[model samples]
Target: MIRRTFPILGVLTAVLLSYGLYEALIGAPTEQSMGDVQRIFYYHAPSAWTAFLLFGINFVASVVYLIQRSIKADIIALVTAEVGVVFCTVVLVTGPIWARPVWGIWWTWDIRLTSTLVLWLIYVSYLILRRFSSSGQTPLMAAVIAIFGALDVPLVYFSIRFFRTQHPQPVIGGEGSIDPKMLQVALINWAGFLCFACLVCWSRYRLELLQREVEETEALEALLDSRKAQ
Candidate 1:
Protein backbone atom coordinates (compact mmCIF):
# COMPACT_ATOMS: atom_id res chain seq x y z
CA MET A 1 0.00 0.00 0.00
CA ILE A 2 2.76 2.41 0.92
CA ARG A 3 4.55 1.60 -2.31
CA ARG A 4 1.46 2.35 -4.37
CA THR A 5 0.71 5.58 -2.51
CA PHE A 6 3.99 7.30 -3.28
CA PRO A 7 3.41 7.55 -7.01
CA ILE A 8 -0.07 8.97 -6.47
CA LEU A 9 1.29 11.54 -4.06
CA GLY A 10 4.04 12.50 -6.48
CA VAL A 11 1.53 12.99 -9.31
CA LEU A 12 -0.74 15.17 -7.18
CA THR A 13 2.18 17.27 -5.98
CA ALA A 14 3.44 17.72 -9.53
CA VAL A 15 0.00 18.92 -10.64
CA LEU A 16 -0.22 21.45 -7.81
CA LEU A 17 3.33 22.64 -8.53
CA SER A 18 2.42 23.22 -12.16
CA TYR A 19 -0.58 25.28 -11.11
CA GLY A 20 1.58 27.26 -8.71
CA LEU A 21 4.04 28.11 -11.49
CA TYR A 22 1.22 29.35 -13.72
CA GLU A 23 -0.19 31.46 -10.93
CA ALA A 24 3.25 32.85 -10.18
CA LEU A 25 3.94 33.86 -13.76
CA ILE A 26 0.52 34.99 -14.97
CA GLY A 27 -1.85 35.49 -12.07
CA ALA A 28 0.43 37.44 -9.76
CA PRO A 29 0.71 41.20 -10.02
CA THR A 30 3.93 42.74 -11.29
CA GLU A 31 6.20 44.83 -9.10
CA GLN A 32 6.13 48.55 -9.79
CA SER A 33 9.87 48.94 -9.34
CA MET A 34 11.27 45.93 -11.21
CA GLY A 35 8.31 45.24 -13.46
CA ASP A 36 8.14 41.89 -15.29
CA VAL A 37 11.65 40.74 -14.44
CA GLN A 38 10.55 40.59 -10.79
CA ARG A 39 8.57 37.46 -11.55
CA ILE A 40 11.83 35.52 -11.24
CA PHE A 41 11.43 35.89 -7.49
CA TYR A 42 8.86 33.11 -7.51
CA TYR A 43 11.51 30.63 -8.65
CA HIS A 44 14.64 32.09 -7.07
CA ALA A 45 13.42 32.52 -3.50
CA PRO A 46 11.89 29.09 -3.43
CA SER A 47 15.04 27.50 -4.79
CA ALA A 48 17.07 29.10 -2.05
CA TRP A 49 14.62 27.95 0.62
CA THR A 50 14.58 24.41 -0.73
CA ALA A 51 18.36 24.27 -0.76
CA PHE A 52 18.45 25.27 2.88
CA LEU A 53 15.82 22.72 3.78
CA LEU A 54 17.72 19.94 2.01
CA PHE A 55 20.95 20.80 3.76
CA GLY A 56 19.12 20.70 7.08
CA ILE A 57 17.80 17.25 6.26
CA ASN A 58 21.30 16.11 5.34
CA PHE A 59 22.65 17.35 8.67
CA VAL A 60 19.99 15.60 10.74
CA ALA A 61 20.27 12.37 8.79
CA SER A 62 24.02 12.40 9.16
CA VAL A 63 23.67 12.67 12.92
CA VAL A 64 21.24 9.78 13.04
CA TYR A 65 23.43 7.64 10.79
CA LEU A 66 26.37 8.20 13.08
CA ILE A 67 24.42 7.25 16.17
CA GLN A 68 22.50 4.31 14.75
CA ARG A 69 25.00 3.06 12.12
CA SER A 70 22.06 2.72 9.75
CA ILE A 71 22.78 2.47 6.06
CA LYS A 72 19.34 3.90 5.30
CA ALA A 73 20.20 7.12 7.12
CA ASP A 74 23.46 7.42 5.21
CA ILE A 75 21.67 6.90 1.91
CA ILE A 76 19.11 9.54 2.79
CA ALA A 77 21.86 11.97 3.73
CA LEU A 78 23.72 11.34 0.49
CA VAL A 79 20.59 11.79 -1.62
CA THR A 80 19.57 14.98 0.16
CA ALA A 81 23.06 16.42 -0.19
CA GLU A 82 22.97 15.85 -3.93
CA VAL A 83 19.54 17.45 -4.22
CA GLY A 84 20.65 20.35 -2.06
CA VAL A 85 23.57 20.99 -4.37
CA VAL A 86 21.27 21.12 -7.38
CA PHE A 87 18.90 23.60 -5.72
CA CYS A 88 21.81 25.66 -4.45
CA THR A 89 23.08 25.93 -8.00
CA VAL A 90 19.63 27.04 -9.12
CA VAL A 91 19.56 29.71 -6.44
CA LEU A 92 23.02 30.98 -7.31
CA VAL A 93 22.35 31.13 -11.03
CA THR A 94 18.88 32.68 -10.75
CA GLY A 95 20.03 35.23 -8.19
CA PRO A 96 22.38 36.77 -10.69
CA ILE A 97 19.74 36.73 -13.37
CA TRP A 98 17.43 38.72 -11.11
CA ALA A 99 20.26 40.94 -9.89
CA ARG A 100 21.43 41.91 -13.38
CA PRO A 101 18.12 43.58 -14.02
CA VAL A 102 17.58 45.11 -10.57
CA TRP A 103 21.10 45.94 -9.37
CA GLY A 104 22.60 46.74 -12.77
CA ILE A 105 25.20 43.97 -12.30
CA TRP A 106 25.44 40.24 -12.92
CA TRP A 107 27.23 39.58 -9.67
CA THR A 108 27.94 41.27 -6.36
CA TRP A 109 30.35 40.64 -3.47
CA ASP A 110 27.73 41.47 -0.90
CA ILE A 111 27.81 39.55 2.40
CA ARG A 112 24.81 37.35 1.67
CA LEU A 113 25.94 36.59 -1.85
CA THR A 114 29.51 35.82 -0.81
CA SER A 115 28.47 33.61 2.08
CA THR A 116 26.00 31.70 -0.03
CA LEU A 117 28.70 31.10 -2.61
CA VAL A 118 30.94 29.75 0.11
CA LEU A 119 28.19 27.53 1.44
CA TRP A 120 27.67 26.08 -2.02
CA LEU A 121 31.38 25.39 -2.33
CA ILE A 122 31.47 23.70 1.04
CA TYR A 123 28.71 21.26 0.11
CA VAL A 124 30.29 20.60 -3.26
CA SER A 125 33.47 19.71 -1.46
CA TYR A 126 31.51 17.44 0.83
CA LEU A 127 30.24 15.52 -2.19
CA ILE A 128 33.74 15.19 -3.58
CA LEU A 129 35.04 14.04 -0.23
CA ARG A 130 32.47 11.30 -0.06
CA ARG A 131 33.55 10.12 -3.50
CA PHE A 132 37.22 9.76 -2.51
CA SER A 133 36.86 8.59 1.10
CA SER A 134 37.01 4.84 1.70
CA SER A 135 33.68 3.06 2.12
CA GLY A 136 34.29 2.15 5.76
CA GLN A 137 35.33 5.74 6.53
CA THR A 138 32.32 7.32 4.80
CA PRO A 139 29.85 7.54 7.64
CA LEU A 140 32.15 9.11 10.21
CA MET A 141 33.77 11.52 7.75
CA ALA A 142 30.47 12.51 6.19
CA ALA A 143 28.82 13.06 9.56
CA VAL A 144 31.63 15.34 10.68
CA ILE A 145 31.59 17.26 7.44
CA ALA A 146 27.82 17.66 7.59
CA ILE A 147 27.97 19.05 11.10
CA PHE A 148 30.73 21.49 10.23
CA GLY A 149 29.23 22.58 6.92
CA ALA A 150 25.76 23.21 8.31
CA LEU A 151 27.18 25.86 10.61
CA ASP A 152 27.64 28.02 7.52
CA VAL A 153 23.90 28.33 6.99
CA PRO A 154 23.37 30.55 10.00
CA LEU A 155 26.38 32.60 8.99
CA VAL A 156 24.96 33.03 5.52
CA TYR A 157 21.66 34.22 6.94
CA PHE A 158 23.25 36.78 9.25
CA SER A 159 26.09 37.88 6.99
CA ILE A 160 24.40 41.16 6.11
CA ARG A 161 24.32 42.19 9.75
CA PHE A 162 28.07 41.95 10.22
CA PHE A 163 29.13 43.16 6.79
CA ARG A 164 27.96 45.53 4.08
CA THR A 165 25.39 44.20 1.67
CA GLN A 166 24.11 45.37 -1.67
CA HIS A 167 21.48 42.67 -1.52
CA PRO A 168 18.11 43.60 -0.08
CA GLN A 169 16.83 42.14 3.17
CA PRO A 170 14.07 39.53 3.00
CA VAL A 171 10.92 41.55 2.53
CA ILE A 172 8.45 38.87 3.55
CA GLY A 173 9.88 37.62 6.81
CA GLY A 174 12.17 40.34 8.02
CA GLU A 175 11.44 43.86 9.23
CA GLY A 176 10.75 44.96 5.67
CA SER A 177 7.30 44.43 4.28
CA ILE A 178 6.17 43.18 0.88
CA ASP A 179 3.08 43.75 -1.24
CA PRO A 180 0.20 41.37 -0.54
CA LYS A 181 0.04 40.06 -4.08
CA MET A 182 3.77 39.44 -4.18
CA LEU A 183 3.63 37.68 -0.83
CA GLN A 184 0.86 35.40 -2.03
CA VAL A 185 2.77 34.32 -5.11
CA ALA A 186 5.96 33.87 -3.12
CA LEU A 187 4.22 31.59 -0.61
CA ILE A 188 2.68 29.43 -3.32
CA ASN A 189 5.98 29.19 -5.13
CA TRP A 190 7.69 28.14 -1.90
CA ALA A 191 5.13 25.36 -1.37
CA GLY A 192 5.59 24.13 -4.91
CA PHE A 193 9.38 24.05 -4.65
CA LEU A 194 9.29 22.29 -1.27
CA CYS A 195 7.18 19.53 -2.74
CA PHE A 196 9.46 19.28 -5.76
CA ALA A 197 12.49 18.98 -3.50
CA CYS A 198 10.94 16.05 -1.67
CA LEU A 199 10.14 14.34 -4.95
CA VAL A 200 13.71 14.70 -6.19
CA CYS A 201 15.21 13.53 -2.91
CA TRP A 202 12.99 10.46 -2.78
CA SER A 203 13.89 9.49 -6.32
CA ARG A 204 17.58 9.90 -5.64
CA TYR A 205 17.33 7.82 -2.46
CA ARG A 206 15.68 4.98 -4.33
CA LEU A 207 18.37 5.09 -7.01
CA GLU A 208 21.04 4.85 -4.32
CA LEU A 209 19.32 1.79 -2.87
CA LEU A 210 19.36 0.11 -6.26
CA GLN A 211 23.03 0.90 -6.75
CA ARG A 212 23.89 -0.57 -3.33
CA GLU A 213 21.99 -3.74 -4.11
CA VAL A 214 23.88 -4.14 -7.36
CA GLU A 215 27.19 -3.71 -5.58
CA GLU A 216 26.22 -6.28 -2.96
CA THR A 217 25.21 -8.74 -5.65
CA GLU A 218 28.51 -8.28 -7.43
CA ALA A 219 30.44 -8.81 -4.19
CA LEU A 220 28.52 -11.99 -3.42
CA GLU A 221 29.13 -13.35 -6.91
CA ALA A 222 32.90 -12.69 -6.59
CA LEU A 223 33.01 -14.52 -3.25
CA LEU A 224 31.11 -17.51 -4.63
CA ASP A 225 33.43 -17.70 -7.64
CA SER A 226 36.48 -17.74 -5.33
CA ARG A 227 34.94 -20.54 -3.22
CA LYS A 228 34.15 -22.63 -6.30
CA ALA A 229 37.73 -22.20 -7.62
CA GLN A 230 39.01 -23.51 -4.25
Candidate 2:
Protein backbone atom coordinates (compact mmCIF):
# COMPACT_ATOMS: atom_id res chain seq x y z
CA MET A 1 0.00 0.00 0.00
CA ILE A 2 2.72 2.44 0.99
CA ARG A 3 4.85 1.54 -1.99
CA ARG A 4 2.07 2.36 -4.42
CA THR A 5 1.34 5.62 -2.67
CA PHE A 6 4.92 6.92 -2.74
CA PRO A 7 4.99 7.71 -6.43
CA ILE A 8 1.59 9.32 -6.37
CA LEU A 9 2.62 11.43 -3.40
CA GLY A 10 5.83 12.49 -5.14
CA VAL A 11 3.91 13.69 -8.18
CA LEU A 12 1.34 15.49 -6.09
CA THR A 13 3.99 17.16 -3.98
CA ALA A 14 5.78 18.35 -7.10
CA VAL A 15 2.59 19.90 -8.43
CA LEU A 16 1.77 21.59 -5.14
CA LEU A 17 5.27 23.01 -4.77
CA SER A 18 5.30 24.41 -8.29
CA TYR A 19 1.90 25.98 -7.96
CA GLY A 20 2.86 27.36 -4.57
CA LEU A 21 5.95 29.02 -6.06
CA TYR A 22 3.83 30.66 -8.73
CA GLU A 23 1.34 31.85 -6.16
CA ALA A 24 4.00 33.26 -3.88
CA LEU A 25 5.82 35.12 -6.63
CA ILE A 26 3.35 36.42 -9.18
CA GLY A 27 -0.16 35.74 -7.92
CA ALA A 28 0.19 37.30 -4.48
CA PRO A 29 -0.30 41.06 -4.45
CA THR A 30 2.51 43.40 -3.49
CA GLU A 31 2.64 44.41 0.15
CA GLN A 32 1.99 48.09 0.90
CA SER A 33 5.02 48.32 3.15
CA MET A 34 7.72 45.77 2.36
CA GLY A 35 6.57 45.14 -1.18
CA ASP A 36 8.18 42.11 -2.91
CA VAL A 37 10.55 41.47 -0.03
CA GLN A 38 7.56 40.29 1.96
CA ARG A 39 7.23 37.39 -0.44
CA ILE A 40 10.07 35.80 1.43
CA PHE A 41 7.65 35.42 4.31
CA TYR A 42 5.82 32.70 2.41
CA TYR A 43 8.93 30.53 2.41
CA HIS A 44 10.24 31.61 5.78
CA ALA A 45 7.06 31.04 7.79
CA PRO A 46 6.34 27.64 6.25
CA SER A 47 9.88 26.44 6.88
CA ALA A 48 9.52 27.35 10.56
CA TRP A 49 6.19 25.54 10.87
CA THR A 50 7.66 22.48 9.19
CA ALA A 51 10.73 22.53 11.44
CA PHE A 52 8.56 22.82 14.54
CA LEU A 53 6.46 19.85 13.40
CA LEU A 54 9.49 17.68 12.64
CA PHE A 55 11.09 18.53 15.96
CA GLY A 56 7.84 17.75 17.76
CA ILE A 57 7.80 14.31 16.14
CA ASN A 58 11.44 13.85 17.07
CA PHE A 59 10.63 14.64 20.68
CA VAL A 60 7.82 12.08 20.75
CA ALA A 61 9.95 9.43 19.10
CA SER A 62 12.80 10.12 21.48
CA VAL A 63 10.48 9.69 24.47
CA VAL A 64 9.18 6.43 23.03
CA TYR A 65 12.73 5.16 22.52
CA LEU A 66 13.67 5.99 26.09
CA ILE A 67 10.63 4.10 27.42
CA GLN A 68 10.74 1.03 25.17
CA ARG A 69 14.36 0.96 23.87
CA SER A 70 12.83 0.34 20.47
CA ILE A 71 15.18 0.58 17.49
CA LYS A 72 12.36 1.77 15.27
CA ALA A 73 11.63 4.65 17.61
CA ASP A 74 15.30 5.55 17.80
CA ILE A 75 15.55 5.63 14.03
CA ILE A 76 12.51 7.87 13.89
CA ALA A 77 14.02 10.24 16.41
CA LEU A 78 17.26 10.42 14.46
CA VAL A 79 15.65 10.98 11.07
CA THR A 80 13.27 13.66 12.33
CA ALA A 81 16.05 15.46 14.14
CA GLU A 82 18.17 15.40 11.02
CA VAL A 83 15.42 16.81 8.83
CA GLY A 84 14.28 19.28 11.47
CA VAL A 85 17.72 20.80 11.64
CA VAL A 86 17.66 21.41 7.88
CA PHE A 87 14.38 23.31 8.00
CA CYS A 88 15.55 25.14 11.09
CA THR A 89 18.66 26.23 9.20
CA VAL A 90 16.44 27.60 6.45
CA VAL A 91 14.54 29.64 9.07
CA LEU A 92 17.73 31.10 10.47
CA VAL A 93 19.07 32.06 7.07
CA THR A 94 15.87 33.54 5.68
CA GLY A 95 15.14 35.53 8.82
CA PRO A 96 18.36 37.50 8.48
CA ILE A 97 17.62 38.20 4.82
CA TRP A 98 14.15 39.51 5.62
CA ALA A 99 15.43 41.46 8.60
CA ARG A 100 18.24 43.27 6.77
CA PRO A 101 15.94 45.27 4.52
CA VAL A 102 13.23 45.81 7.11
CA TRP A 103 15.10 46.38 10.36
CA GLY A 104 18.22 47.79 8.66
CA ILE A 105 20.17 45.00 10.33
CA TRP A 106 21.10 41.50 9.30
CA TRP A 107 20.63 40.10 12.77
CA THR A 108 19.46 41.03 16.23
CA TRP A 109 19.83 39.62 19.72
CA ASP A 110 16.10 39.79 20.40
CA ILE A 111 14.34 37.13 22.46
CA ARG A 112 12.70 35.47 19.48
CA LEU A 113 15.89 35.45 17.41
CA THR A 114 18.07 34.29 20.27
CA SER A 115 15.73 31.52 21.33
CA THR A 116 15.48 30.30 17.76
CA LEU A 117 19.27 30.27 17.39
CA VAL A 118 19.49 28.30 20.61
CA LEU A 119 16.92 25.84 19.32
CA TRP A 120 19.00 25.31 16.19
CA LEU A 121 22.16 24.85 18.21
CA ILE A 122 20.51 22.28 20.47
CA TYR A 123 19.46 20.13 17.54
CA VAL A 124 22.84 20.52 15.86
CA SER A 125 24.40 19.28 19.08
CA TYR A 126 21.95 16.39 19.17
CA LEU A 127 22.96 15.39 15.67
CA ILE A 128 26.62 15.66 16.54
CA LEU A 129 26.20 13.47 19.62
CA ARG A 130 24.45 10.80 17.58
CA ARG A 131 27.10 10.90 14.86
CA PHE A 132 30.32 10.96 16.89
CA SER A 133 29.51 8.89 19.97
CA SER A 134 30.79 5.37 19.59
CA SER A 135 29.07 4.03 22.72
CA GLY A 136 26.24 1.56 22.38
CA GLN A 137 24.26 3.88 24.65
CA THR A 138 24.46 6.67 22.06
CA PRO A 139 20.79 6.27 21.21
CA LEU A 140 19.79 6.74 24.84
CA MET A 141 22.03 9.78 25.13
CA ALA A 142 20.67 11.25 21.94
CA ALA A 143 17.11 10.63 23.10
CA VAL A 144 17.78 12.49 26.31
CA ILE A 145 19.25 15.38 24.34
CA ALA A 146 16.23 15.39 22.02
CA ILE A 147 13.85 15.66 24.94
CA PHE A 148 15.86 18.53 26.38
CA GLY A 149 16.06 20.22 23.01
CA ALA A 150 12.32 19.96 22.52
CA LEU A 151 11.83 22.04 25.63
CA ASP A 152 13.45 24.97 23.83
CA VAL A 153 11.04 24.79 20.89
CA PRO A 154 8.17 26.18 22.92
CA LEU A 155 10.38 28.92 24.34
CA VAL A 156 11.40 29.92 20.85
CA TYR A 157 7.77 30.05 19.72
CA PHE A 158 6.46 32.12 22.62
CA SER A 159 9.41 34.48 23.04
CA ILE A 160 7.80 37.22 20.99
CA ARG A 161 4.62 37.06 23.03
CA PHE A 162 6.39 37.05 26.35
CA PHE A 163 9.04 39.65 25.61
CA ARG A 164 9.77 42.69 23.52
CA THR A 165 11.31 41.67 20.20
CA GLN A 166 12.31 43.14 16.84
CA HIS A 167 10.56 40.27 15.06
CA PRO A 168 7.19 40.91 13.51
CA GLN A 169 4.04 39.92 15.41
CA PRO A 170 2.22 36.77 14.45
CA VAL A 171 -0.23 37.21 11.63
CA ILE A 172 -2.57 34.42 12.59
CA GLY A 173 -3.20 35.00 16.28
CA GLY A 174 -1.46 38.13 17.49
CA GLU A 175 -2.17 41.85 17.05
CA GLY A 176 -1.44 41.81 13.32
CA SER A 177 -3.54 40.29 10.55
CA ILE A 178 -2.72 39.33 6.95
CA ASP A 179 -4.57 40.20 3.79
CA PRO A 180 -7.06 37.51 2.81
CA LYS A 181 -5.24 36.78 -0.46
CA MET A 182 -1.85 36.70 1.27
CA LEU A 183 -3.24 34.35 3.89
CA GLN A 184 -4.50 32.02 1.19
CA VAL A 185 -1.16 31.98 -0.59
CA ALA A 186 0.69 31.40 2.66
CA LEU A 187 -1.54 28.45 3.49
CA ILE A 188 -1.01 26.99 0.05
CA ASN A 189 2.75 27.29 0.40
CA TRP A 190 2.65 25.76 3.86
CA ALA A 191 0.70 22.79 2.55
CA GLY A 192 3.33 22.24 -0.12
CA PHE A 193 6.16 22.50 2.39
CA LEU A 194 4.44 20.04 4.77
CA CYS A 195 4.09 17.50 1.99
CA PHE A 196 7.73 17.97 1.01
CA ALA A 197 8.85 17.41 4.60
CA CYS A 198 6.83 14.21 4.91
CA LEU A 199 8.35 12.85 1.73
CA VAL A 200 11.89 13.59 2.90
CA CYS A 201 11.32 12.07 6.35
CA TRP A 202 9.92 8.86 4.85
CA SER A 203 12.90 8.49 2.53
CA ARG A 204 15.39 9.11 5.32
CA TYR A 205 13.71 6.56 7.59
CA ARG A 206 13.88 3.87 4.90
CA LEU A 207 17.55 4.58 4.17
CA GLU A 208 18.49 4.48 7.83
CA LEU A 209 16.73 1.15 8.27
CA LEU A 210 18.59 -0.29 5.31
CA GLN A 211 21.96 0.92 6.61
CA ARG A 212 21.23 -0.72 9.97
CA GLU A 213 20.38 -3.99 8.26
CA VAL A 214 23.67 -3.92 6.36
CA GLU A 215 25.67 -3.15 9.48
CA GLU A 216 24.03 -6.02 11.37
CA THR A 217 24.65 -8.42 8.49
CA GLU A 218 28.35 -7.50 8.41
CA ALA A 219 28.69 -7.98 12.16
CA LEU A 220 27.05 -11.36 11.99
CA GLU A 221 29.38 -12.46 9.20
CA ALA A 222 32.46 -11.28 11.10
CA LEU A 223 31.34 -13.15 14.24
CA LEU A 224 30.75 -16.34 12.25
CA ASP A 225 34.20 -16.08 10.69
CA SER A 226 35.84 -15.67 14.09
CA ARG A 227 34.01 -18.71 15.42
CA LYS A 228 35.13 -20.80 12.43
CA ALA A 229 38.74 -19.64 12.97
CA GLN A 230 38.57 -20.84 16.58
CA error at residue 3 for candidate 1, angstroms:
3.1
Per-model TM values vs. the true structure: 0.89, 0.91
Instruction: List the candidate 2 regions with Cα displacement exceeding 4 Å.
Output: 152-175
Q: Encode model 1's per-residue lDDT on 1-230: one tens digit a residue.
A: 86996787688778878888888889898877789998888888888888888888899999998899899999989988899999999989998898887777888667667777888998999999999999878878988899888876677767655655455543222325688888888888888788777887777888889998999999999999999999
Query: Which residue segments of model 1 deviate by more than 4 Å?
Result: 152-161, 165-175
Q: Which 10 consecutive positions of candidate 2 have the poorest summed lDDT?
A: 166-175
Residue lDDT tens for model 2, 1-84? 999988888988999899999999999999987889999999999899998888889999999999999999999999888888
Error of 1 at 115 (Å): 2.2
Q: Predict model 2's lDDT versus the native.
A: 0.86
Query: With candidate 2 superimposed using the best TM-score fit, by how many Å does residue 230's alpha carbon deviate from the native?
Result: 1.3
Clashes of each: 0, 0
